[model samples]
Target chain A: MDLSALGSCVSQVSCVVTQTTSGLISGMLLFLVSCGLTLIFGVLGVVNFAHGSLYMLGAFFAYTVYVPTHSFALAILAGAVGTGLFGIVFERFFISRVYGSDVLMQLLVCYAFVLILDDVVKMVWGASYLSMGMPEAFMVPPLFIAGGVVPPFYLFLIGISALFGLALWLLMARTRFGKVVRAAAQNGDMVAALGIRTPYVFAAVFALGSVMAGAAGALAAPVRSLTAGMGFSVLIESFIVTVIGGMGSIVGALVASILLGLIQSFGAIGFPLFTDGLMFTFMAVVLIVKPTGLFGQRVR
Target chain B: MQAKGTIRHGVSRRAALKGAGALTLASGIGGFPHIAKAAGKVIRVGMNTILSGRVALVGTSSSNAARLVIDKFNAEGGAGGRTIELVVRDSKGRPDEAARVVRDLMDVEGCEIILDSEASSGAFAVHEVMRTRGVLCIHTNSETSQLTADPKMHIPTVFRSARQGIQDAVGGGQYAAAIAKKKKLTRWMTCSPDYVYGRDNTAQFMEYAKIFDPAIRLVEGAWPKLFQPDYTPVITKILQEKPQALYSALWGGDLSAFIDQGNLYGLFHNIDTFAVNLGDYSVLKAVKSLPKGLHSGSRYNRIVPHSAANEAFYTAYTKRFPGQWPTNWSWQNATGAAFMCDALKKTGGKTDGKLLAAAIAGRTIKSPFGVKGTITMRAEDHTIIDYAVAYGITEPVDPYLTDIQMADWGAILEHEAEWKKKKGYA
Candidate 1:
């Protein structure tokens, strides 16, 4: 190739790289959120529509903690632990009653919680948008990746997401609890026959899933404006990610999250007007072509 | 239908029941009971707007302003001793819901006038309802140009008290054009919501900007979905394009996210950003650090009008609702209520829609937000005129906007006429 053409080609490649990196930044955050939805749906056998609200609560809880302590670590901890406890309580009282009921009944319960949670948020936060500025640790300058600039916090998210993924794998594969959880997923009756307290297992799984969502929200707090119903958009995106990744699959969520991130980044660039529908379109195609997601187990 | 034998207080039960039934039938036959109750006593003014969801503040401010005006009017012996009773309903930011709620206010609640405080999305729907209902409506929150500028969409009973996109575009365009000329900035990109108001506002701003300065070119336009939480990708594209300047119509949480994210990416540091909707208290208070040197046209800044009446009203609003500043909707709604009151007063408390419309047509009234201490309800089109539209550089401190520059109404109207002509709008 001629020198000028080669220079242009290199620039184009660099542009692609930059956009991809940007996609990965959001991709990592989505994975953090969607994995929890997948986990909760898998083990709980109930679609947790209130996962988004949990995420919102996580961010607000973090905000509550952060305002007083101003420690990012404490805030994140408060987000995770607070949401985890909230999930336990909700599951123990409301969700547990409708565990084996109709999906619509469960959905109604969740919808009720959604409305109540939104009201509660308004009551506490006063219905105004809030900002918990990036933590001191994350207050670094933008990093250049392949001739494009990006926030360093985004890179931090990617690293943290990777670490979380690893820890999740270890917990699910290396531990006896993971074995029992997997057994419960395969056949809860058999796990019960094997003398396992299936209820405790379900509660633990819900709490764990909620912790994931809380961490994601805490991570996302800096990147987003904390509004009354801010969890909604995250919920929609997480739903999309969960569906595409095959609900209940950690590996699938990670892969699908990145794919979605890239699609959104590229789709926004190419088809700005249809960008809103792009993710739904992707999900529709996936549901049509393969109801069982990439990493999900095929039903008999 | 009454029993033959019954007694209470010197009357049989049958007789009392018969008497009650006759009275009810007579009242029903003579006139609706509601009308009888309303006659010379109360003028129920209906209002419908988003009262729930993300933009509830719009409804809150609009409702509060109307309350402020209505309380004063009622206290002053409202329009010939008929008190103005506001019957407000929440639309939940849904267009169809807004229409339904407005209808309920009119039909179910016996409201005569509609004070539509919906955003553009729901306002248009509410507009259609009022067109058929034929009740005088003063749109208090919508800023979409076609809501007023398009003669095709214009209804006799529907008038706008809020600023229109064309008005702000001309003003903001001229203001930004001057800045661009001084700085010799040519490349421009827009980051606006991907909706009617956003697209129309951005297009108008760009058109007027080009009219004012032919040297500028639109490099790119980023249209994010309304209430879009993440502005990362859009911000990335803008940064990559490296436009010399930018404009955005994104407001509320969307605008806050854009500003905060843009700051992180150094998007504003390099680009001369002019987000017109950035002047709201929501955005001003929400942003992490109010970035310096950002230029925005006034939406609702207390210091812009520089009038005693405006300051007094601001004081009144703050006093009424402490710690919460009145938004742009507050002044517009207050203006709308005042206009309705003035018309009612002119007609000596008549609720006749046509008469009230005639009273307000081309009438200039004292306003807290007016440039010259008065705002005119333009006769040719039922929109506003001579409001204190301006632009200024932003600061990080109180009076967050500095060096406030008011836009010329003459220029705005002149350009607005040209724009209408271009759009084939009467």
Candidate 2:
């Protein structure tokens, strides 16, 4: 091969690697948010429309905590715990009442929560964009990988998401509590008949999901602008991820999020204007091809 | 003339006095307006603004500034001894909502004059209502050039106190062109919101920048969705393209977010960032830290005008709000209020829309920041002319701009008439 041809091939390979890295970072962020949505659906049998609001609250909590403490880690912890407690309260007061009701009724209840939480956020934060300064650690020089330089924060995000994913996997698969939760997800009536106290399990799952969303928000606070509308933007993307991955499927969400992220990362470079349209198109094709989604189980 | 002591609308003089007293108490004036009301009757002015949702900061600051001006007027016996009462309606950043609320302000609220501080789309909506209803309207914050530059959209009773997008673009482009020439910066790219204002501003800036420096070449244009929370991909792409300079029209939260994320990728270190909206205090405040020497223009910074009146408004605004910086819209709306008061005084407190509009037209108002000593309300298009067109580098603290470069409006507006004619707007 000619020297120029070899150079071009090397360049192409570098481009692919950079785009893939970009995709992974974005996908991991989406997975962090979507896992919570899917987990809630799996255990509670209710799609929490206010899940995005919980995520937004996490960022705001991080900001509020970060300002006084100046500790990003502490802020993240506070955000997660705060949102988890709020989720518990939300489930107890609102979701618990609408349990075993029609899907539309449950949706309305969650939608009401969405509006309430949105206003609550606006009232607290004011209707302006807020941002967190990047921590000193993430502000270091980018690590050169292959031909492209990667921001250290992106790697930090990826590492944290992977750890969380593993921890969640172990919790759901390895523990006795996990077994009961899984059983409740499959057959809540049967689990209740067996005296499992399914409400507690459901609430626990919802809290866990809310915590994950909060973590995602806290993690993304430095990366994305904190706005009242941030919740809605991420909500739509998470919904797409949950749907594409198969609702209530954690592994499915993980895979779908990465796939969507890769599509977005590449689509942004190839067709910037149609990147959003590309995502919806992918979702439409998935739904048409497999009504149960890629990893979604068929209901008996 | 109607007799003062005689009964009108089935209310006796004594009863009317009692009702007015009850209203004065109910409205919570707290006796401050007692003296002003005794001097003359109140004149109601309605404000249609985006008081809620994402862009509420703009509306809130503008409304606050207008209130400050109105309060000052009321204290000084108001316009021709008529106390000005500002009734505000939230437009919610929607055109249809703006029209509806403006109609309600005019009809139900019994407002004689309207000041709209909405975005361009909402401003156009309110403009239609104002034209149909024959209410004198002063636009405070909308910057779409077509709202005033296009003769077809002109109405006798409508005048824009806000600077036009074309004027900003022309001035900003010239400013950037000079820097690009001097610094040997050639390659250029644009990253603006995917909307009318963004697209038009970017296009106009590039078109005029090339006119100033024909050597400059635009390598790429990225129009991110409006209010897009994440700008990582856009930032990365810009870095990869490696433009010598970039023109960005992103503002508010979006701009702040972009700045935050872009800083991570060292985007500013690589490119000469010429953002039209970076001079805005709201966006500047939102950004965690201002990168030194980021080039921008069009939005107001208190020091850029360097006039006693500008300093006084800035001082009063900051004192009133406490720790809050005055935004571009704050001064624009305050100027609008001042102009309205001046026009009302000229008209002897007559609320006749056309007469007041005529009085304002072709007249120059003494503004703290304007070319040729004052800002003139152009008789032809009813848009304010010769407003200050200055660019400056970003600084760390309050007064965000330094090393200011002022532009001649005559040079900036030289081709406006010809260009409008070419576009068949004349």
Q: TM-scores of all models?
A: 0.92, 0.92
iRMSD, model 1, in Å: 1.8
Instruction: Please state the CAPRI-style docking class of candidate 2.
Output: medium
Q: Tens digit of lDDT per residue, candidate 2, span B1-426?
A: 578896657767888899998877754443333233323478888898998888888888989999998998899887666889999889889999999998877666667789998988989888888777667899999889888887778888889999888888788888988999999899999999998888999999999899899999998888899988777767766766789999999988888888888887777987899988999888887787678889978477777678787788788888998867777888789878888988888888877888899889898888876755588888898888777889999987877888989987777778676678778887
lDDT of 2 by residue, A97-144 (tens): 987788899889888878888778889887777888887777776666
Worst 10 residues of 1 chain B by lDDT: B29-38
Please report the candidate that would top lDDT against the real structure: 1
Q: List TM-scores of chain B, every candidate.
A: 0.92, 0.89
TM-score of 2: 0.92
RMSD of each: 4.3, 6.1
TM-score of decoy 1: 0.92
Q: Provide the overall lDDT of each model, using Cα atoms, as 2-decimal numbers.
A: 0.84, 0.84
With candidate 1 superimposed using the best TM-score fit, by how many Å does residue B60's alpha carbon deviate from the native?
Answer: 0.3
lDDT of 1 by residue, A94-130 (tens): 8889877888998999989999999999988977678
